[model samples]
Target: MATRRFPTREELRVWRDFIETGELVRSAMAARLQKDGLSPGDYTVLLALSEAPGERLRSSELATAVGWERSRLSHHLGRMEKRGLIRREECLTDNRGAEAVLAPAGRAIFQQVNRPHLRDIREIFVDALTPAQLEAAGEIMAALREHLTRE
Candidate 1:
């Protein structure tokens, strides 16, 4: 069979639905997070640090964990540092490198917001889907991730 050069009407419709639904979900989550004084980026960074050994990670590792470029992460880290959410310290093992550490304030805020975040997720996503649909969604995500890695 020849490869199609363009999506069929049905494929286009599904693509639009997927993109729009993703944006809606992202918007809802961002709104909820903002109400608790954290952006999605902030939450992502905090969560990574909170899970790392010693509640810290090297700056490059942090950028990778958050899937952000070094420059973007550095700027955001600066803002977060000013807000007392995180601190950068010279890496003990590498004089030229630094580590992102979850400050006490960051940890406290993360703890405060985590439960409500979960509740929002449950209400906005989980409750909208059947258990089987949820499982299928997970599988779909895995497939997409695998495909992206091959590219």
Candidate 2:
């Protein structure tokens, strides 16, 4: 059998640091979002809806936009509907599909939460990096994304 190359010790250590730090930032951001009664999933869905043309997207499109599976989106949409944050309508173009529309409440609340979210991002991430480091981080992320796409 051919030997498979594992990450070298230094590479492994760097990978661990990257993963752990990313998790810490995500946790901190989630904590801040919880104050606005929004989970990351809620925020993600609202964000996608808010950006769509006419502030609405097909259920499948919304799922793709939020990078969630259909069932997960369906369940989260149910809770959000109960809270009056969003409303679902039968898709006008497709009888068998549905659409997710951003409700007035959802738009208002997303606007309210957006500023603080930006502040949290700056605090947890941008402020910690120097200009050069930030540029490097962007480049590194782009490289990784490109590599993934290739694979």
**CA lDDT, every model vs. true structure:** 0.95, 0.93
Model 2 RMSD vs true structure: 2.6
TM-score of 2: 0.89
Instruction: Please identify model 2 stretches exceeding 4 Å from their true place.
Output: 1-4
Candidate 1, residue 102: lDDT: 95
- Writing each residue's lDDT as its tens digit, candidate 2 over 59-126 gives 99998888889999999999999999999999877899999899999999999998888888899899
Looking at model 2, the pairs that clash are none
Tell me each candidate's TM-score. Answer: 0.93, 0.89
Candidate 1 residue lDDT tens string, 66-125: 899999999999999999999999998999899999999999999999989999999999
- The residue pairs found clashing in candidate 1 are none
